[model samples]
Target: MNLETHEPVAENLGVLEIAALLRELTAALLDIADFDEALTRLVTVAQRTVPGVTWCGFTALRAGEPAGVAASDPRLAELDDLGHGAESPAMSAVHRREMVLSTDLAAEERWPDWTARACALGVRSVVAAPVDIDDHVIGALNLYADAPDALTARRQLTAMLLAEHAGLLLAGVRGREQRTALTNEIDETLLQEGVIGQAIGVIMTQRGCPAPEALQVLRSAALALSIPLREVAERLVVTVSRSRGA
Candidate 1:
């Protein structure tokens, strides 16, 4: 929230440069449709736009299992190895719903195995921020650098903002998808009702049965055939039309 407070990192661009980069990144985010694609695009953008970010990745809970879903570089595949049981910085950020920064991975002791592995991969520092939307932590964004103390306070703020932006964009995309699905369901229901009503009318005209009796006939045929009433109604309507043509 306090974008103006921290001192700029030496490895990073000036304030105006970062602003322009953020604008371009937002444009890229808007252009993406799939959530997985968006996450991959975001990590790639972060590695390019954020200073000293050698690699980037995101960890999210998918189908109740925690896993790394995206990474900017192939080397960052180490992220995927951090299974749900791994106590890595990304897990910490998502669990705490806050930022987790480590300036010297070699000396880090919180997660010895993770730190050692990252150091072996030439990653000396990292910053992880939780992607939170609607007061819920959905995932974590992680940025890595090969040098010590690379992710300064200013860059951390920028990373946090980027994570928040990603969360908001994801929420918007999901909302639109849900609305579209609901609309499709409603259209299908109305179409089925109309067809079934027409079939009932046909039965009444041909058999001289009341509406209730005609509906019972349709239901009975459906149950005998182990199918839906709508299916029986649809078949009746099609058959009567074909008979008239004959």
Candidate 2:
């Protein structure tokens, strides 16, 4: 909830241009119905505003579970081609609970196997920080440039701030999903309960039984039919009502 005061996002560029792009980014994130589209807009804004970053992207994981991102960056169009369960050296760094940087994979030894793959992909340097919330690591934020000097203290700090914002937005999205699921479950339960109550009433009137006896009849029928109690109740209610009408 830290609303960091946004100064003029553009210092050297014209104020109008900066304002327009900032406004565009804000609109895209707020108005876009697709979460992926919103994150794409966010990545675009980060890359355009930040210096020395040839690539910038965010990874989203589900409910603090271990997940991977098919990160979107113009530099690595092939990233989208990676099949499931693929990993990059940069991703391993975030998984290891540390910020990782490789000045040159050709000579670096930190992520030996991962570095070789990255070098083949034309990435000379990479820096990544973990995306986390409430003390749980969800994913990672990664940046890469062809040059070794692509990282700076200012740019790195900005990247961390952006990752924090990503975490908050992700948490909100997950909360909304949970609320929707609960609402659906409640609706289904109400519908089923009404049907079951109607069936119990039919049994009571037809068999001259007490309420608990009627319920037992329904339970027995459900077991015999090998169906849900609610489904059995619905069928019994329909059958009894139809016979009365006839």
Candidate 3:
């Protein structure tokens, strides 16, 4: 297959060839453990596999705002930044939930400023495919080419396939990160509760009071000192331990 031209290599790719390509993509991305690394790998793979793709980038929503997450080259990230406006092809794909293509930046009228800047960076043609990470998170896979009419139907199809795979992999990575964060939070909460329980027990023994009364005394001390309940409990436990050691 001619990797530089927009012409279709064949009427349709053979089933075996499609499967092989998919296998290659899966192998390349499956072992990635970090979300940012996975996004970086995705753009790298797109640049490697897509025809006429001089540079590639991935942009996604971060903390409710769109940001450039990864790029095959640093320049591509700069191009992505220019693509945040309403007329930008990348943001258009994300907003329209479809593919957006610009055959020639010189002739492009919708995004004059963006095209001017992209042309200055040697990008003449571009394609952007929406990557749906989840119901809530949508991203764009942007492909840039140095020549006009570089992104044909066949090339766009390849870009879309890569974007679909990226969505799945990124979603899995994000899910794992969220789960790990939740598990850590739970563990910290349990540990704090245990410390507080121990502190309450100490107060109960020293004051000859029930658990509720001991807890109230601990709260009163925390309020008076203007410290957190957890800090108060930790200090009391440490003080008691040191006294016993002495």
Candidate 4:
């Protein structure tokens, strides 16, 4: 994050205005229940709020590979395909961990082929900002415009701020997902423990075997069946219950 660009976003969007927009975006992002949904909503918000942005999308990388994309319009996803064989402006932003601005795509010297493709789509200007989380660039937010020089300095600064916020929100969503998965794993372990304990008790009562010995029997059965210990315990308990009823 550059301190020079870190000042107020835009004079047109005063402190109060930017603050209100941030609050709204934050609330909406927090309400998202899944990571994929959050990514989609992040670009949607950028397209709606940023001036002269005709389209918005994001390209995420993992282990230096292009992983996935989320765009406001499905057709805009073609931008990510450009990232595969050649270095488009968006991937360059992600790799360099900085913003890449092409005020006029027609004269983009570095990526002439990509510029020609984008021109065919009626895109004349583009601005991409690295979605940095904890100083690591995970993705880039790509904004496109139909007219040249549409993303002015002030607008670019505003887009950068929004991209930063999206990164934070994405990190938070990932954290929540990991925590939930861990909790579910713990719950499953507890349920398996209870089932195995009940099966051990049944074995002890029926065969007068010690608890450890009964547990060993259950483990042997699991190994023989090539199944989980919990499945073996469940089958044993069910069989015992049925025999008692009969």
Candidate 5:
């Protein structure tokens, strides 16, 4: 195998070789926990496994615009930014929810401006495959090469398979992140409620009032002070602690 190009020295990859490549990809990404880190790892894997790929990047749609989310190299990130518009292969793949291939940027007529800019940046061939998560077209995986026609049929297939795997992994990462955030939010809410309950009890004892009347007084104080109920409750609790200590 040619390490630089990641291609077989004498022939295309056999079935076993392809299986090995897939196993490598799965092993590399299975342990990632963060969404951004997963995307970074994905691009790194693309550069190592895709034949003739000199650079790799991931682009995500934000507010209906393409944004470079990750890259195997810093230069690839800059290259991804150039494709933010409709003329870029990454944008096209995301919009069409399919793969877009440019065999030679110099001879490409479909996106003249993008081709010109890519060529100037030493990108001669490109493959962009849409990444889908839960039936939604979320972004694109881009493979770039410095030699014309380098992203051949086999390379395109590899890119597509990688994109599919990335989508599944990213979806799991996102779900876990969301669950963690929700758990934290719930804990915070419960803590705040406990503080408010303590404040209400303090008010009841100090003013010789019922629980409902104490709560009403606290609400009135919060309204007059133009502060949140939680803030007022926290302040009251802290003041009582200080007074008891003194």
Candidate 6:
């Protein structure tokens, strides 16, 4: 965490610039870090004010995985298979160093792992715009939708308008160690670790399955539903509670 932790940098705001709201968002992006509080704030504004955006989120390339950098939508469950390649469109964009537009996840047909997961979670389409600096792609802005055609040519025009601002912000904010520290909480914070370890033990004892098998069951349900494993855990706990009338 040696890098700057999203302290404010801009002060002069009296003069109103002549540009669209999205353009202004892009301009402000220059001051945000990869995991900065400003980044989350931007998502909030996008969800609240930006048109044609139902869900707004950002993901950064981390050791070839698309890590959830930030998000504004609550429907978006936390992704678990971020580390799995071929299941990550955002990571693929970083590899190709290009943006990806999915007009229809069912019709376009690519990246089964990612698409299947998205479809299971009710994501009909997506637009993944690359976050590049200098020349290398670092991460992506993923806009999910319930329709086939979510973004139009005008939207890209608007997104690119903002991307330029974001690029500068990302380049200035991104660092290996800092990003690592933020992403290192997956195993420890989620799944059979800490609080979850005790829960898994209960499941194993009740279901007569080994700990490994119980864990496998969780992963399988997540894969089947194309949702995060945590969501499955929440459901299991709820189901047991209801059965016991708790």
lDDT of 4 by residue, 182-243 (tens): 86676455444788989988888878997767777877889999999899888988998898
- CA lDDT scores, all candidates in order: 0.76, 0.61, 0.77, 0.77, 0.76, 0.60
Whole-model lDDT for model 1 versus the true structure?
0.76
Candidate 3 deviation (Cα RMSD): 10.4
How good is model 4 by TM-score? 0.71
Candidate 4: regions farther than 4 A off: 1-13, 81-83, 134-137, 195-246
Residue 222, model 4: Cα distance from true site in angstroms: 31
Model 2, span 120-163: residue lDDT tens: 77777766666664344376667777677556544555555566
Output the lDDT of residue 243, model 6.
Answer: 82
**TM-score of every model?**
0.66, 0.54, 0.68, 0.71, 0.68, 0.53
lDDT per residue (tens digit) for residues 118-216 in model 6: 787778877666676433335666666777776654554445445555666556555533565665554445444643565566578789987667776
Residue pairs in collision within model 4: none
Candidate 1: the clashing residue pairs are none
lDDT (tens digit, per residue) of candidate 5 on 118-230: 78888998988888754332788889999998877667767776788778877776677678688667545544478888998899889999766777788899999999988
- Cα deviation of 185, candidate 1, in Å: 5.6
Off by over 4 Å in 3: 1-17, 62-64, 82-86, 190-246
Mark the 10 consecutive residues where model 4 has the least summed lDDT: 1-10
Clash count, candidate 3:
0
On TM-score, the stronger of 3 and 4 is: 4
List where candidate 2 sits over 4 angstroms from the true fold: 1-44, 59-65, 74-98, 134-137, 190-246
Model 1, 81-176: lDDT tens digits are 456246888878877778888888878998887887788788899888888643332778899999998887778878877888878876665566
Model 6 — which ten-residue stretch has the worst lDDT?
1-10
